[model samples]
Target: MTLETEFRTRAFEDVRRALLERREIALLDVREEDPHARSHPLFAANLPLSKLELEVPLRLPRRSVPIVVLDDGEGLAQRAALRFTELGYTDVALLAGGVRGWAAAGGELFQDVNAPSKAFGELVESERHTPALDAQEVQALLASDANMVVFDARRFDEYQTMNIPGSISVPGAELVLRAQQLAPDPTTHIIVNCAGRTRSIIGTQSLINAGVPNPVTALRNGTIGWTLAGLELAHGSTRRFSPATDGAVRVAAAAAARAVADRAEVGRTTRDEARRWADEAVRTIYRFDVRTPHEYESSHVPGFRSAPGGQLVQETDMFAPVRGARVILADSDGVRANMTASWLAQMNVEVYVIDGLTPADFTEEGVAPPARNAVTPPASDEISPAELSALLQSPGTVVLDFTASANYVKQHIPGAWWTLRAQLADALPKLPPAQRYVVTCWTSALARFAAPELAELTGKPVQVLTGGTSAWLAAGLPLETGETQLASPRIDRYRRPYEGTDNAREAMNAYLEWEYGLVAQLSRDGTHGFHVI
Candidate 1:
């Protein structure tokens, strides 16, 4: 089915129909996160053109699967289509009107990242009536010596950022597996909180669905609601979940997770069966290790990428963009994978958990490599960090840092100008003309891959800084900071409304309001094959 051809355009109606009918489709947004966050279709996944080559094989495995590239009139769709062709993606097309056009065509646009998963979380709460306690109620519990434990169902780093006092970091997928160990007393009340809503709702429901003996409730609106209620947050909390669990507890957790998965109609597959599924050329299959990153790094099944169960459930669109793709989750512990698969099944995905695996079966250790490699810079164009530092001393040397905008602001070469490879052509016009053009990124991988394009666009001498800014820092070289001399707009990352303490009340309220209405929006879309099993 090598149907690769000149990229064509697709109207919103055509894309909508494909989605409603459950046809395999990857409606990709090829813009930066900031721009992508502002608005996109309900199911559109962000695979920015800057990282397309690096992430395409992982996210969109089936070359022949229907793909519709879109952008906000940044002239990016055509470039992305060309890159897809170069990368052997056979079935690629462009959205007829892009993001704005979708709105013009009456297609609903959603703000924020991970809208699909977030909306699914909302649907689960609506259908399951997942129990929840407001901030004030939880605050009172904290004030008193209540026999309750608040578990922050977010990444540990997030918990460390701002969390409810006395809350322990027990990420969503770990809730059922580690809850018993953390709160050995069955009567201890369990409260889960995330930055906003999705993880908290999912985490609390996970324990409830698993038939946990304790009362489980979500902190409604999570940390946002806590803040809105004039509550103080604990920062830099290093609380971690207790790892030790008795055999009886593990047995009960496995049975509970299995039961929940069975109720959700999640498929069970053996190692051989999952391998067969992955080998099938007709369908796209994403294999992931749903355990914690530390566990994954210690040992994981071969060919499985590390995507923490909680993040995977919250960011399905990012991990597996193909709406109707098959997903296989692996975990040595029966609890995490099954629990993650249950939610994915409810999200209308063909999800399966690999069963009957042991520690010895997971022979692979260390982080799994990326699915695809980008173009390599020629040796002739590679400049060592030492050489580049000396070049910076002379005039007419202009360095463009193509790292993420936030990273560029945090640190870069002293006189480096920040730019994006996706918008380098536009950014070049604003940058100073120079005898030599030096490009660098955080690790230099992106910059190296971008050398050819910059060389072609500029028709000038181009060189890539070896090891990028990281190498410069490693060399103990002086570096500059702040968002100075920016050649491009800082739109690489979206500032989530629920993060940090500086979010405006209006934005936080509006975000919660948006989530509140996701069920309705999902209904109007007439797609999202979601169910609350």
Candidate 2:
């Protein structure tokens, strides 16, 4: 038997009562962006109908929580309610009469919720959001405070050309990642500004989303607003340097490198040491010539794989998770691989930069890495196609093709997985270990960087498809490009199993609420076995 459910019509006052009574409620305003930005309720979160599916879930406490959806006289609530039900969300209720109804009932509306209203109001009152600062206010603040930090969110190169005086340069994407680095004190109030409003809004919102505790408010209208107020914007072509490291960082790193090099009893490896590693074992001392996957396929070191440098560095754990594992990083320019090795060294991993000049004439110090030879392989070291074919046929083989997204789509080898060097850190945990791997790129340098990393992901016997796909074609081997094949069990995305620790904080939040009886408990009496420290 099915029970017919009655629809409940919720009023603005009734919703307010629910909030005051401490009932779970999400007051979502469904409106287009321009209207929402112009005027919205103080606490109302704008999850526009177009982007509601993506934004609502991110904002809500839970799917089951009561969600009051409303729109501005557009008669869109019913459609939104049905969409929510179709998307498998329960407990979504319609707000009667929309924003107009709430306004008729004398409900208060707010401009923005992502920003702290009191601070923003003060900024607006002071006209700090305008382009120009009044001479009096500027003098008073300057006299009262000398430590206030002002930041300009623009490209560094652009800042060098022209920027406001005493403003620091920080790119938009760099804000969240570098917030703490820029301001160590939580009490430090950050004033973010851009040449325009969009970047300021987005940049300020990013800080808020990243959970920055410091108070942040954007300058309204940005530098343009400042200019309208008759404020002077500075112009300069010279570079501006931030604070110095006091010789501590460089000095400490040098000391550490010297100590480690001494303890290993390995000075910069001589040509002999480098060659010895290459010839030591049939598969030991695997070399990767890091480059684009396409180049690697062309031809390379007989045993080298194509591993890109960026991916190799990002997925160091996936590439070579083993502690004290030996790895050689090779790149055409040799600078990229060597630079990557320097960073890996800081992590205490054993990685050497190899300038695989060629099969013959491996050079010593003072010799420029062989320039890319058009007749042979470009100055970069790479694996041979024949060796790559051999490695692929071997049981327990892992093959990687590190090429750009566009190139990989055009053509690639069968059973070869295209991996972006940047995403390696995030992608490796899910890879399989049943087989050894041969990584390839457009050149051997990248393979040198990426191959060992593939080995580290599975801790299995591995080798590089030296010389990349080129080596395979050179050896008259078959290639499967542009196949768009499904990822095999060996290289498909891997999902991490949920662990108790992963939800420890969430469990604790639930426990506290349950203890206080502020919010209903998910289960009775410590079934979750959660404790807070």
Highest lDDT: give the candidate number.
1
Single out the weakest 10-residue window by summed lDDT for candidate 1: 371-380
Against the unseen true structure, what C-alpha lDDT does each candidate score? 0.88, 0.48
Q: Estimate, for each residue in 1-533, the C-alpha lDDT of model 2 and write its tens digit.
A: 11133335588777767644534556666664445544444335556554344334323413455667777765456656765665556777777777777767766543322312222223222332323333334434445775455566655665665555666776553454345556668777666666534345445644553456767766654555554455666777343324232244333333443343333332144345665765553222434555444445555544445555434533343343222335665544333344345434533445666533553532222212331211121232244666656666765655666654445556667677766442454556545555556666655445555555455556665555566666666767876766353232221121111112366445334432322331122111111111110
Candidate 2 wrongly placed segments (more than 4 Å): 1-7, 112-149, 153-166, 170-225, 232-533
Q: Of the candidates shown, which would achieve the greatest TM-score relative to the real structure?
A: 1
Clashing pairs in 1: none
Q: How much does each candidate deviate from the true structure in C-alpha RMSD?
A: 2.4, 22.9
- State every prediction's TM-score relative to the real structure: 0.96, 0.33
lDDT of 2 at 433: 52
How well does candidate 1 score on lDDT at residue 407? Answer: 91
